[model samples]
Target: MRATEVAMALGEPDIHKRVEVVRTRLKRLIDKGWLAEHQRGQFSIVEGLNGAALNGAAADH
Candidate 1:
């Protein structure tokens, strides 16, 4: 999902700040090799991880 989509799903009160926070956090996950930004503003779990496992791994960060 895109940062804006995540922020909206989380129901953040501050739209602008929430998007920024989500984007930053997503970048962190990318740096940790947990996720890959395949396209601008789009992200997905890295190879070798299924959706269920990815959710657990993401929660760790």
Candidate 2:
């Protein structure tokens, strides 16, 4: 999911904190090779990972 989408889904009391959580999660995913960034802030799912986006299904939160 996109960053904006994830932020919206998080719905935390503090918007900044929510965004931070999302960013941290994305970074971890990148380190794990589950996601590949297309640009500075854009990302897509890594190939051959069974549809696991770096952001994970929890972004639907």
In order of appearance, the predictions have TM-scores of: 0.69, 0.62
lDDT of each: 0.78, 0.67
User: Residues 1-61, candidate 1, lDDT per residue (tens digit)?
Assistant: 8888877878875578778998898899798768999999998878775445454464344
Best by TM-score: 1
Please give the TM-score that candidate 1 achieves against the real structure: 0.69
Q: Candidate 2 residues 1-61, lDDT tens each? A: 6665666766744467777788778778777777778887776677666753444442322
Off by over 4 Å in 2: 10-14, 51-61
Over the full model, what C-alpha lDDT does candidate 1 score relative to the true structure? 0.78
